[model samples]
Target: MAAGGGSASDPLFPPRAFSPQGRACLALGSPDGRVRAWDTQSGRLRHEYVPSAHLSATCTCLAWATGRPTKEGPQRKKRKSEAAESVEECDLLAIGTTVGSILLYSIVKGELQSKLTGGHDSKVNCVRWHQDNGCLYSCSEDKHIVEWGSQTCKVKCKWKGDSGGVSCLCVSPDGKMLLSAGRTIKLWDLETKEVYRQFTGHSTAVSSLMFITERPSSESQPFDGITGLYFLSGAVHDRLLSVWQVRSERKEKSAVISFTLTEAPIYVDLAVSENKEEPVKLAVVCRDGQLHIFEYILNGHCKKTITSTSIVQIATSGKDDGSVPTPIPILAVAFCSDKQSLLLVYGNTLQPVIERVSLKTSEPHICLVRDIQKNLTLKMKTPILKVKTPVVKSETKVLVPGIPGHSASVKSGSSGTPVSEGKRKPGDKEISIEEQLGAMDIDSMKAVRRGGLPQTDSFAVLLVQGLESNDKNILNKVFNTRKEKLIKNTVARLPVYSIVPLLHELTTRLQGHPFSALLMVRWLKAVFVLHASYLSTLPDLVPQLGTLYQLMENRVKSLQKLSRLHGKLYLLITQISASETRQDVTDVNQTAKLVYEEESSDEESEDEMMERDSDDNWEEEEEREEQDVSADKEINGDSDPDPGEESEEEEE
Candidate 1:
């Protein structure tokens, strides 16, 4: 795989997307611009589609968007054939091509819905679907990130940066934040359509971005205090996997935990288990046919870092029998719905294959069991039946690009085509504007303060109100929102006077709801971070801080003891289970031995009985033979006289 070069004959690692709604099927694209949806469980192709306008274009990326029901228009009727296959509830799939066009396909209709074009001038690298709003985001080599309306295929807004063209894009779960990466990574606020924060770490262009979502525990008291955002970024050129923590700041440094891989990774994905005990699993597909998996858990105590506990690497190059892996280049890897197995797509385009690999970790080595039954070959051709699509009256809106932070030009027109404008040297209009502003004097300016009541139901207002009133329910609302941005904004905008009250409310809440220790501690830390400078100046707040510290200390002590107990009990139970298993095996062996001995004893007794019967029969036969011999002696004497008399009578 390492020796191969980028040629037409070489195998292509195309992008793949699994259905988010059901996880029943996944869409895989090929270099020749063909997309195939395969059943995740059965590994059978449900439908194969080619973009209508992309006859010669190459596919670069794929994304599956769950269909959102809208009252804006009636749903289109799916064909009976497609409905029977249960694709009527299927979602939309967005496919990016090298021709700078995005093809939207309807899984229900089994056809292309619309072709979004002219947003990019170069090959599209990444396409992400925001399911919350049905909007589509795509980044391209043209150095622009374009946002397209869901119903209208027109570009809503276009963003460009000078960081050597955005190569990858990631949308936060709430659909409020967007992450674009190239030479540097930039987090964009989707609501404001502005770069919220930027991060610098990877020396080369980033190839993949995945958000690591920490699912809440299913326990009676779930860990509901995950306030920090964590994601993973990897660059093929840099050969590094970086874990980044999203912060409300201007810029940040490299990833918290930087893991250098042996081979350049082509794709990366994160799978969050529903179980709280299971760590967030990350899978990286490397160029050397090696799939590296890292399981990490976010430590709320240290919100900025994740505990990278277990790492397992398996080769995706061998046959399904877990044979010695060949050096075949792997194209892509995806976590199955079960999270315990992986769906791997390797081999060349001519004989492209998809296989499910079940992974198990032992003490020293990871075991891989390839599911031969689910190994699907993607080389088969399914005849494409063209479905007639109704004519959609498209209203193309003129794209007004925003000002560039880096050296970037705004693209305009219906197709999002780049409208080149000459660089203006502070033009006459700008000079006049500056002169008008400079001409205004202090005497002409009057400060105006507009007073209005804040929205009582807003997150910030509710938080402040809750702090003043000590309303646990209101505070729970703020916490239960689970929106990290809202929480941060509320904390940052908290009034200086209410700082003590906020602390008091947090302490009181902690006392009542001890299960929310993580949340309470995190809020306490945030308060200190924001008001550490002024907090010491006020000696009156010292008592409250002390009390809070004591509460946390007690909680920590108890938690430590419980952790030790859990560990000991787990070890003891495991040993007992092992012993019991051995005992059962021993019992089975002894039972088999006893049964064998009983059968042998029974056979020996039967043999002795047969010997006794045979001896008795021999005695009886001897007595009968002696009696017969005496009878024969008598008969012979009589027979001799008859024989001679009969012979003389016959002669006469």
Candidate 2:
């Protein structure tokens, strides 16, 4: 599985919501009217349900309905095993098509059960399942909605919708009220079959809408002592994201929280957490390939930051393939239940890559943790795709700019026109504005000091874009490997603020290995070299850097003192050696004597020890003097030894 479903097949429009099967399984409907089930955990294809009559109609909407309630009926109580079997059989799928049709398929039965047709004048845009009584509600471009029974697949009720079309819709968790978006968001009463309240703040058509149940921090209490839901909507033209704090019974009391995005928005999702301290999170993906995550407390004070970004660059050196990356639309983005990973889908032309990107965000420095889908095929969407296999002849090790999970063996299709490898058409080098990034934006990020650099996720994504192959596993190795020099060089490339998070990670690693924390010295050196200009301009960065410098200096000075002490100890030992000496006549006449004396042992004082050391020195000096005298006499006797020989000559 090189990537997700995106290859030659185009993605169904963003509004075709996925139905989550058993924990991680997802059911998706394609424009070709194909309803396939996939396991999100392993990226494996599961099932392809054969519908009765929607094979050619474009799939526009999907909804999953479970037949069994929380407590099973009397027939399910025959045995414990029957209760378990009943739950699996209750799951059903409803798919809406562009030709104004709805098809219902039973999962356990493995067959298309029923079909409803000709309810609208135009294409069906949205379909939702009402949990109670197996009722399904659907809306279409004909400005009408029809509620049908899941059993008979017959219309139960009908309501008028927006004048133009129903762009999107969702049923409440309780399945009583309906939320729909088109020109404006309308909340409808299912029982009364009339629009109960209309929320209007958009200057353009609303393209996306969702009703998310607000999870209170303390389950025992309600939000501000009131049970509620949150209504989120995004407009296509103005690119405005609006979130409403909706109370359970008060549509008039709803509060509007809105924001403008950098690019036209594609999709938005709410991420819930179990931890009370971690605020409720929201993620919004734009058509320009930017993902922003916003966290807010219950008080509505929001802290928003850009988490993931997409940038493209052309290869310029011999090691590079000279291939450029083009920014494409992000179809959808969602956070897994763990809140530490992001699964995203984006494939505009050639490369429709679905990536499960790991996140490291606990520390101040956010970085790419790892790539869950290691085998994902990375495609570069560009005019280069118009040729056969787009092979670069250079033996360069550098990675080409493209999608993440860089692939070395991604062969282009056989359908494109063939051309010489090194040749390009005229004006091929004229890069479009969307393909290139502005200089000012990159400069501002580089100049950050006190405020902080880009968030860790964005920085990590930037690092990935900088690489030729988008090989994120190298980042995994850089953090986990034991090689000292490699860690040193890699850490040098990270920004200065990254040290804050890296230090926290290394600190945890330091508990088991005492010496690993010393790597911070190298980190300090890198920060100095890379951010030297900011050191003076940014006054607040001084104190922390100075402390690290002092620590390194102290360690160096201690090593120097130890080195000098070793040299002095070596000289002292050399001065205390013994040599052989010749004896003389005066030495032969000398006599030896031994004497013993008793001394008091009342714990020797410092003074007495010093006195004894002085006495030993004096005795050693005297002994040396006597030995010198004997040596001198021996020398004189050797030179005067000829005196006996001279007397003998005179007598002769």
Candidate 3:
């Protein structure tokens, strides 16, 4: 399912909700070189493109930065005098891809205007355009937030810190304070680019942040001392919705109060009502199935101290159990206020569903009966709430290109133009969109997803969708996802599908990434294990064992080449050492003998050295004979020494 709130003007799919600017539409980036645009009202494909065809990278994030048209080179754009008045320009869609590149596509022209690369070393998280002219901000998991000049397509400045990778960021209404939401919320002065205040209330990583105007219109009433700089932030886990009051003059942020809902919030968006009676409210969808609406109320000197008290206002149909809250998570939410207090919510169902719940009479109650108002009336037309997790459903679309208004003048290269920088023969054929679609595995293209991971990560969701899908083009999308993920875990989770198709895909999808060999080996091992235990029982699969043999053979050949190179490197290193030391002998015993010979030469000739080492043998013999003769003279004292010993001594 798609996550993140769209412009206030647009609602979720079947996009009936509208703003004066234009009808709401959605731009979705997928793995198969397509950026799809869908009409919000009719839930139909509007525009699609394959800007970076050779990149073959999955889309990570998407943003619309409304500003003056980016200046394409003289060849791409028309002169001001020749401009057509019939066409209206829209905001540029900054499609952040998995390869750390951004595509600036003109939604109006339905063509690529510019492309950016190498600004971030990792996948782009969020790309937001400051209301300021031509200024945009992009953040990545690489811990980099780069400000870009949309017109020049160049990085203007970079901001980084120890607080860690940026999860989300929101610009204050005044455009002075840039609040970054991560493990902690940091307020940075946009001009100085210095972090002045760090909000530490959140103990874990925060998912998103948005600024809300607390005060009413100046024409309606005056909020003399009220702080206008307020923001709402939510976390990725252990979620709490914190409403912060920013006192820029005081250089501080005070957490007015936070509510710990039953589930961690997946997305948070704020909407203000034009109705004079209605206050500013927040719309949230959580991991656990639930839809929440909160109103920002200020009282008692703009209170700083917080409490754990619940500020819940669940809309139940009956009077008997109006207090209990249900955990039905909404897929998308829109707080519409042309003149009415309506909240539109979409659920995960077989077909598309949009449930509108009126909140005009819903006054929040803190403690049960102490603050109960007239009544809590809600029309629960559908029961879509799940107690445990977010509701997710699969979306399967065919690979047909140029859906309706979307035209495919596919472009490539760093500039997002049709210029060819890659090596190509003059007569080489440029693959048409049809051929590209034909090349993809058609069967695996059917996508399915079921959890929170898919909501945040474009790559994971797409691959998991393909893994569980029944389309032949599964390899095209799944390969991009599988390249980064663990092969073992993915193979274990994949539903029974044709392994032969996916294995053939590894040849193309596994290119341009590191550790391809390792991934292939792990994949082969998993396939073998699955085949022996389970897939082997199936009929035509018996002949498919050749796929496993081919994988193993390629692996063996690679290992052999690797070992051969290793031996060559070792031999070269050993030869260099031997040449420097002048030692030809490698045998341990030979080395020992050589050392001994050197020592023997230092002392004397070999024979003389041994005799010297033995020492005084003849002197000992002569001494023994003399002692024996003396003992014979003193016969009684030394009867042991005999005549034969004395004779032998004389002969010596």
**Best model per lDDT:** 1
Q: Give me the displacement of residue 558 in model 3, in angstroms.
A: 30
Tens digit of lDDT per residue, candidate 1, span 547-633?
Answer: 888887887789889999999999999999999898887433434434334566556687789999999999999999999987897
* Candidate 3 local lDDT, 503-535, one digit each (tens): 544544344354665555556666667655566
> Which RMSD values do the candidates have, in order?
39.0, 33.1, 24.0
Candidate 2: tens digits of C-alpha lDDT, residues 1-652: 0001111023533333344433344566664567776555566666677554545465666667766534635652367786565565567777777678887777666678778875765677667776676788888878888888766767777778887787677777666788887777788877886876788777675666666565656767755422456667777665667766555565553335656667766666666544456666666766665566666544442444223232211112222576443434455566775766777655432223356776544443332222222355778976654545465543433333332213222222122312223455574554334323331123344335435443654434444433434344543444444555654566556665555445434334444454655644454455456556656554345564555556557767888898899989877766543112232224554565876656766666989899999999999999999999879989887545578888898999
**Top model number, TM-score:** 1
Off by over 4 Å in 1: 1-10, 52-55, 69-89, 215-226, 249-251, 273-278, 300-330, 350-352, 367-652
lDDT of 1: 0.67
lDDT of 3 at 397: 22
TM-score order of candidates, best first? Answer: 1, 3, 2
Candidate 3 or 1, higher TM-score: 1
In model 2, where do residues sit more than 4 Å from their true spots? 1-16, 21-23, 49-56, 67-90, 215-227, 247-255, 273-278, 298-319, 325-330, 346-355, 361-652
Candidate models: Cα lDDT each: 0.67, 0.58, 0.56
